[model samples]
Target: MNNEISDDNSDMIISDSDSNSEESIEDLNWIQTFLEKPGNQIFVEIHMQYLTDRFNLVGLNKYCSEKMSTMLKLMTDDIDFLRGEYSSMSSIEKRMLDKECAKLYGLIHARYILTYQGQYDMMTLYSENIFGKCPRSACTGTPLLPMGLYDVPEQDSFKLYCPCCEDVYRPAHITQGLELFSGFNGSVLSEYKRYQQAFDYPVEKHLTLRDSELPLGKNLDSEGDDLNIINQVLKFNPNIDGAYFGTTFPHFFLMQYPNVVSGEEKPKQRFIPAIYNFDLHYNSQILRYQELKRQQLEEKLSKEYDPKLIKTKSKKIFTSKTKMYT
Candidate 1:
């Protein structure tokens, strides 16, 4: 009888261990794949904690429907089924749910970036311009911060803000379906000065025609017309090389002369660039001042547009074929 009892106890212990192992494997099946990816292992604890409280997921429901909201909860609320039927669901269904889950996580991320921890995680990427560099030649490859025009999802996609130009531009690279809130503009921008100090990104001074008293439309038929115009406006010879300085000049001149640099200039459609068919409104006084200066320059240029110097088929000859904005 004593031997039989010991055998029964050992059998029970073995059976329990097997069950526990199976459960562990199931739990690992989904999250383990993500955790195995580079740079995600460190966030294991934090990600788990983010899903622990419902409060952290506020405002997520507005972006998803009833069914999707349920799926998001099932995926996040339960520690055991964190991946939410990824193995059992059909591929199409799994993809749809996965998309919603990802968006929900983006909403969470937007909120997270406002916090101390998320800011720390994003600081490296922000400083590195992993999102993209500013498209403007004047910005000089400055790192960009991702921001959304609207806080609501599906209303708009992400935009990149250049700290140097203090203007937002569409990302140079296509981001597919990634949507985020404008939380970065609020929190990240508020802390940007501190970030610059920490990263040793010295504030750079860029020359602008706005502050200069330049002869805008003088001597159109003169030798070295481009250099003469630039020199008079910039007040210093910026070395009219076919590189950075060359690219920078046309942006200011493009407004006055549509094909100033021909193939190099972005199509002169609008003064303020648009993002995904949405017109971007500028609140920056500096941009306003620059636009005023550009208008003044155009007025002067218009007075000197000799029919011999500048050929025009129509009054508005410039039209954009591409959607890219600088």
Candidate 2:
């Protein structure tokens, strides 16, 4: 009876161990494969915690936008079965979810890094020189702080900044480039300063183009405005290589319309595909062939004389010819 009880206990312990291992694997499946690294464990937990709590997010639709529903479902899986399902999903779908997850995490992490808790965790990494050391021999192996060139996300990657040197240095690891960072560019008061900030105080260099000088067209009262812009363009670009400066600016037909503001250049929409620089050689060749065919047709039509009297000799001497034949 004592042996049977010991055997039963051992069997239960083995079963529990197997179950725990399965659960760990399932949990790992929920996160991105790259994120499963032991070094990234803390960050992955923080990201999931933030994602689990919707209150931390503002404009939840903005980051993932169209993928919000799917992303949310994929992100919020806490159960073993739900987490296990992640591996079974299609590769395209998995990649798409992973992308949105990364974007969402990045957005939150940007804000999270500013928090004391987040900074404390990051500071630990900082001390270890995980972000990389300043390359300059002046400060040998000085751990660099991750700072963004622009506070705006996606505009640029986080660069390692050397406090000792006050210059940007390449990160020791490429993964450090993905770390959350805020730049001094957002405001002089922002947590960090630009790499150039310490060396030279930034002097604002805004050019105030004389708006009074660049009128789109001549005034109704006088043709006074016509020469102003031409003079200005010549004043600026005095030297030219190929073409002599034409008095007239290249004006689009849209500029003459009352609805279109000629002063402000219309912005291209971000969503719209701009084909301005796209190679349209094949399309142009097709159009050229069609144009030639049209020109030929027009030339033929133009050459034909209109309504020249063609007197039909229907009352011909056909009678004489018929009689001779008979």
Candidate 3:
């Protein structure tokens, strides 16, 4: 009886050892598998979705209006030959359309880089020409108004100073206007100084263009001319270089997509496809950001999580199994 009891005890010890070893192996395998799965390996998708939803296409459009307008004009001009009756257009017209589409693709690629880089640069060369300069002391205690002029109070105007040259010049008279000093040439350095001072509560000079000098009519006339040219080209050849039919051609093609779709003849939805693409691109960016964030979080957790706690949990799992078997 004593021998049998000793043998039984030895067998129990061996069985417990095997069970613990198996559990450890299983746990390690699970951890390894979790680490290996591509999707599970990181929070890339979450980051991408966050990026996509965070990026606003409307905001991008507003930011790039001038650039987009220029691109549209160039595209229209390139495809002018194709904007007539199909029967009237020759082989040259087809060739021109193809060339214009290719040009547009190049333009899109270049513009994407330009716009992205401009965001980082903060100083837009286009805005400088279009909106003009912000006066030195326009709003002493307010945000810098790049696209508009601020009215400077007399009390605040006296405190104006240029941070660059340390010029303690008082705000110029409202009538004098903040002249882009002839020698200054509106360099980035000057602009940065002006922007910095504007952020602070420094006084600013307010300058307003006279109503008669505004050139409102000239601006309208230019826009009208552009529209006329676009219309003429569209009249000649309705197909807009095959890239969604130019910006203006969509309004007329709305009915062509009516639910009679059997083949790829489906008309493109007004804005959804482009919007979807934008969202996808935006989401992808967000996902990347999230993945980076997640990685940081994981690293932090790894450092902060006590190995003692994991060991304790493992002991509980193994100890409970030993108790049951014994």
Among these predicted structures, which one has the highest lDDT?
1
Best by TM-score: 1
Compose the digit string of candidate 1's lDDT tens values, residues 173-251: 4231111222233442333343334333221211121223236653322424333322222221111111101112213
Clashing pairs in 1: none
- Count of backbone collisions in candidate 2: 0
Model 1 global lDDT (CA atoms, 0 to 1): 0.41
Worst 10 residues of 2 by lDDT: 237-246
Rank ordering of all candidates by TM-score, starting from the highest: 1, 2, 3
Pitting candidate 2 against candidate 3, the one with the higher TM-score is: 2
Candidate 1 clash figure, as a count: 0
Candidate 1 vs candidate 2, TM-score winner:
1
**Per-residue lDDT for 1-326 in model 3, tens only?**
21121322221111111111223321322122211221111101111122233232123333232344333433333233223332254556433433333333322322232233422222232123211222444222211111101111111111122222222332221111123222344543354355335332111110111122346654222443432322211121111111111221111122232231222332222222236346566666776676688679867887658798778878999999999999
lDDT of 2 by residue, 55-172 (tens): 7777645645436655566555545434566556766655555556555655565556555565556656554444555666656455555555443333343345555545674332
Q: C-alpha displacement of 71 in model 3, angstroms?
A: 10
TM-score of each: 0.40, 0.39, 0.16
Residue-level error in angstroms, candidate 1, position 238: 35
Misplaced by over 4 Å in model 2 are 1-25, 29-34, 37-44, 47-49, 80-89, 172-326
Candidate 2 local Cα displacement, residue 254, angstroms: 53
User: Model 1 Cα displacement at 181 (Å)?
Assistant: 32
Candidate 3 TM-score over all chains jointly: 0.16
